[model samples]
Target: MSSAQVALLPGVQQFLDRQHGLFIDGAQQAAQSEKRLTVWDPATGKAIATTADANAADVDRAVMSAWRAFVSRSWAGRTPAERERILLRFADLVEQNGEELAQLETLEQGKSINISRAFEVGCTLNWMRYTAGLTTKISGRTLDVSIPFPPGARYQAWTKKEPVGVVAGIVPWNFPLMIGMWKVMPALAAGCSIVIKPSETTPLTLLRVAELAIEAGVPEGIFNVVTGSGTECGAALTSHPHVAKVSFTGSTATGKQIARVAADRLTRVTLELGGKNPAIVLKDADPAWVIEGLMTGSFLNQGQVCAASSRIYIEAPLFDTLVSGFEQAVKSLQVGPGMLETTQINPVVSQAHCAKVAAYLDEARKQNAELIAGNVGPDAQGFYIPPTLVINPDANLRLTREEVFGPVVNLVRVTDGEEALRLANDSDFGLTASVWTRDLTQALNYTDRLQAGTVWVNSHTLIDANLPFGGMKQSGTGRDFGPDWLNDWCETKSVCVRY
Candidate 1:
């Protein structure tokens, strides 16, 4: 694989020159205590920055700042058009700093610069612009009613969507910039204040986003970022009394814990958690197309994507052929540093995560799963895991049951479509799944039986800003994007009057 082309932009030094610490109440501030944590560049395993480690006291300050902003006239009392203008300006600012933001995201999160440019930065810009249009469209509904007490009196009732006050937006590290936008932009569009606690592994892009948001004329305390470990900062934010809601994106275990904490205040919560997604290949499907789809689905973003198709089910007739073709594709993928234009597969997020994946592979081997190809980690300073495929996986094994969250896939064969549906729905997770077939009826039938939130007929891992994205069952609860997402950030109030 080719080495990355590291051409730092002219303004990057200036951007990096700015304080790289917690942003509280619209300004860069030191941690409540003097403690700090190092941020690493996963591509090269180098320390990029040492950010302040916020504690409970810092969480108190940030949440209170956001609470004050939520109730202040400058934020909560602003007209929809006024809010729209700020959001539009924020969108423009994102575009202005698009390249720099994309570079920071790639350097910090271990995603390819190409993906950061195209998906992360591009989607965030689009989301801000889209939510700007939605701000003015948030209207109340009128209802006509009858009054029983007085014969001459008529009643009027209506419902309006109002911001739910201070929101704790706990974002995941997988797609930091874009997912942060998913949590913050919609709440801001609905006229709420937000306190973002980004994942410890990838917090730089979010802090930079908050900086740009303040620059775009968002009021002080309207948007804040506090970075620290999940146990310290994350738990505090969720349990804080002033936090009206918690928007979290991470693993199922953490989401459950957040849900429990939020229950104390009965605070609303939106959780986008883990997935052990599946992809089904029919007998008559073309080998070339199936191979391409499986390769992209199983290894995209080094398979760290939450909705990636990790568990593959193929019909018995074509099982061996599909596995063989997929092994070849995985073997030929270009794995290297993320900034390289020619690199297809980048390193995993960290050395610890690489070791975790290695342990999973070892477990699979002990359980007698057939390793198809590519178990070799790159011999370098980075956290690299070669794309690996295991065939005829044991249904009860950890690799098949739990989320591997790496560039690893397990292939299994089924007798027919019925067995395929049974095996696909057998797992505890049901986030996303795909079915590849030329027959439309078979596709529709299979989709109906698959237990997941989003079902792709012949594709995999394709997401749009306008579609509702989340999971069913143990995967997660609540949704992101689409029209329903506005409901996730706001609460509905009913008003009735008699005249």
Candidate 2:
């Protein structure tokens, strides 16, 4: 908390004062409604910028533009090598502006500037380059089907993967820049044009990135940004007839709403929804390593991560050791503004979000849950919440059952890894889960039984560029990385010819 605050770069200052507009068809314009939303810096809770709040009309324009581009093959028609070059150029531009984007994300999304740089911007740079690498890999297979429909006719048949069409991406406020790219990058790699609707609170970085796409030589309508509330623009974009697929990352409730709307049109959807993600510490795991891994997985970005391990199940014999370790680790976190170099826990994105986390804590206290650490009182400014560690939470408590999406972690004791796996798989949300063990067999045993996407052994929250990420069960559908992402973004067409 004593660390000095980092000075703002001039680019961040200019962006903070700018009045931004919706990006459609490679052009920026005021929203049709002319309504706007003020941007805020979470560290100071100050209004820093304003951006157009697109209404239904603006949604229509963006979608239609993307649809036209898709239909006309403006972006999709390009050769894979051409697409790869442009995407690589875009990645390079993002890398060059990394500092500006990281600061802007910290200002808008409320994570530490260091995290914004390392995880948000830095990881995004990697994903962008990886997705660009996937351009040539987006392909189909040659299949041989035996048939006797015509006695002496020979048949040549094959299958091809084609871009689905115009895509609609709705991103959440937490880690906006990174998650937005999760939706945008793959769709582009598969040659599908896209329109992104960033969360109202964290729209600035995406808006800036869209403009940079132009500098990277991406065509108009290939990458678009629309900023507005979910009810207005989000709903409009998802349900639009021209949209072939909608990729959404948010709460379970909102994801369901989008699925319902997309259902009417049979539109494909890739939803990364809510998670009560679990981290299991088996009896054989070292307490020291478990403590360090959980500290990063649960407290990074102040635990705004959807895949964050909020619900932790420790084997009974090792439970107290971990509880003590986590308590001390949580207490040691330097809670302050993210711009400060020494700040380990930053404020949540908004006052409303802070209050939401507060309500859960209040309810946990009422349910007789024990808080061993993270009750370091309020900061003088901003929407801050201490990194809270709760134990002995009531079985029925929402703190243990739901995704707090904040720096609140719940610890439960289990008899063994069996019990830990059982309890971990006991949630409706299974976006991610991790198991820690020295036994390779035990870890491999979990691969088939964890019932979640992206299970990790000995680590958690480590998202790799080559691995596929997404939830199973209600954690949501579809994958987000590597070749699995391309599968979701494209449709396969089987062609047969008689020669």
Candidate 3:
């Protein structure tokens, strides 16, 4: 499209015009060393922003700020009702600034403007509101004790839930804004001060949101954002002695490292990690409906979603028809820059990621997988790859077993629901899976048997703030969303008194 004809999202240009910095002590500050990372516009494969590259010194400063805030009770000392008010106000500010945040996310992260608006900003707002409601509900129960202290003395026992002091949250490049919200909001609601380490690749949206948070009347040092390479800042934040809890969302390898570090300190940890999720289409599933579910499960957000269904298992009876339908849909997608309103498929996060996804295709051909759709080629100057589907790649191949984390999927044929179930559970990842079928009995049976944290029946990747979302096994430990997340940030203390 010509420059004259290009339709840009509101505030896209305005966000691109400014220089962003890190958020610490409720203010925007530059890196102490005057270093910056060149953030890429993956859509155009151009440098759009220079983000402050926080070093160990910066991480220490943010952690100290959070510790002071926690000790002083700037946020944690407030009554739950007051915290709720501030958080609800923060949600309001997020809603008010939704357009700018969405546009900024689309520019930096290279996701569609529609998705940035709906999922990045809109869903974040809902999650914030949901968490805000949980603030006043963080309570403990009174218990009766069967003990006597000093001859027939009455005893009372109760428990109290307290914030785990300072929290460190590390988010990934994909879904930066949404995942950042996932980390910070619940911690803040629980009255714990936080230091956020966003992916160096996409730090703009998090920085801006932290600014909005302060504007919503959150006290200083309650929420801080540090931007830099994971090796330096992320390692420093997770290893810092002052951080009482660590909440990280990224690769399983990184999550393991964080776990090891946090374990040394005995710090509370919650990790939402990687997935090579499967989508199983049972024999009773309709081919047309199943194809739509497959597309959404496999390719939403250009297939960068961790819970995105990358491995597809189809019952033998429905294999031919479902595969043909999926191929047609994949071929019809429009791949281009997110700035164009007409584009359906956007570029992957970077040139490096694009190459990683491309290599999988080369290996698939060598392994004799049937390439049903997509082509590996550079689209203009952007890091674009067409939505791809391969049929029956060897189950043991890297493309089949590992997370491609791009717009690519593998289709496998299974004889029955039992075979499909066996193949689906045959993986190191147990993040999520989807079972498409009209048979309610079969769906329930598979739901009980699937090793994943969440199994969708006739749907995929549908998330709600009320429902818990996380992975089992190597996918990661703990959960996000729902009331369970609130509990993870708090420590239960039991008190006993004799009268």
Candidate 4:
């Protein structure tokens, strides 16, 4: 790579040198344990900074603070319109600071700066605005009661949607700002105070956002962040007595552990876990379009996306042609640091993740899975893996069965759309899947049978704030985004009276 290819944004180093702390109550605080974790830049395999590592005590303090804020109703007590204005202002702050946040995100998480700006900061701004709009729209209903009572007696009943109290928002490493917003915005929009636990690997953007929230006039303690590991901080948040609901986005295994902890407390929980999402290319789909969708679907975020099109099935007629195009696209991607404007494949988040992704390639070799495209090892110093593709792997093989969570995808030849659906629905995970076809009838038919939470036609990995997004089966539980999320963050209370 040349100097121009590795060029970084100015001031990235300055931003990293600043000390970061856990955001609790309305301020930044050192963890009671006085421990910290080193934030790494996977793009260069370098340590960026150390962040305060909170433990159980810190979690308890933050949760209590959130609970206090909720009960005091400083934020919850505000009129919907008032809350809306405040959050909209927060969105403005996010937009104003977009470049800074995007830089931090790219450096901390090793995703392309373009993505960090367009998807992370830009999408989060949209999410905050959308959730702000929801504040005014969150409502309950008046119900007509059927009562067998004395003549002329009248009874009426209505329901009030109440916030679920203090919320524990556990976000994952990928798309830290967006997922953090997804977890916290809805809870706050529903008038619930929240304590956010960002993945230790990527905490910079969330911490900054919390500060911006305060500046935007969100009441102190309405949003808090406790940075630490899953064992100490996350476990504490899950079981905190003040935490009425737990919203998490991470691995299926971790989600299960959190679910068990939440279950013990009977806490309301919403989980968005892992996915081995499938993208099917039907025979009738345009070659050029399907090829574009396949490349974007599989390689976006270096395939770190939970709902990435990691597993692809193509009808036999189009498999060879589509795979050839995909291979060319994969080969053309420029792999380098995120700050490089031309870099298409940025480094994976960490060395450990890169190794984990490599193990799948080793397994593929052992199973004689045809290597369609990719480099098994990093060509550069950072935790990088070239976009990888595999073909002809056995249906039950680990390569096809597991979530690689890297820049790797599997291509399988199917007889037709029906066979494609059968193979696509075979996974235990069903977070998302996409079908490319011009046949509306076949697309709808496959859409009805594709066992995933969000299915796309002629597109992949596209999401919006107005839509509900979640997983089915082992992929995880409950919905996020849109009105349904507001309901999930709230409890419906029925009131009836007789006159």
Over 4 Å off in model 3, which ranges?
1-14, 375-379
Candidate 2 scores a C-alpha RMSD against the true structure in Å of: 1.6
Q: Give the poorly placed runs of model 2, Cα more than 4 Å off.
A: 1-3, 375-379
Candidate 4: list runs displaced more than 4 Å.
Answer: 1-12, 149-151, 375-379
lDDT of 4 by residue, 210-319 (tens): 98899999999999999999988899888888889999999999999988988888998999999999888888899998878778888888999998998888999988
Clashes of each: 0, 0, 0, 0
lDDT of 3 by residue, 187-241 (tens): 9999999999989888899888898899999999999999999988889889999
Pairs in steric clash, model 3: none
Off by over 4 Å in 1: 1-4, 13-19, 375-379
Worst 10 residues of 1 by lDDT: 372-381
Question: Compared to the true structure, candidate 4 yields what TM-score?
Answer: 0.96
Q: Write the per-residue lDDT of candidate 1 for residues 1-499, one digit (tens) a residue.
A: 3345867687765665555677888989878767887778888898877777889999999999998888875786989999999999999999999999998888888888888998888878888898788888887799876658777777889999899999999998889999999888998998899999988898888888888899999999999999999999888888999999899989999999988888867999988899999888899888888888778888888999998889888999999898778877887877777887778888888878989998998998898888866644446558888788888888778898899999989888989878888889988888999998989999999899899999998899988878888899988888888866677777899999986
Q: After superposition, how far is residue 57 of candidate 1 from its true place, in Å?
A: 0.5
Over 21-65, each residue of candidate 2 has an lDDT whose tens digit, in order, gives 899889887788788898888888899899988899999999988
For candidate 3, what is the TM-score? 0.97
* lDDT to native, each model: 0.86, 0.88, 0.87, 0.88
Q: Native-vs-model 3 lDDT?
A: 0.87
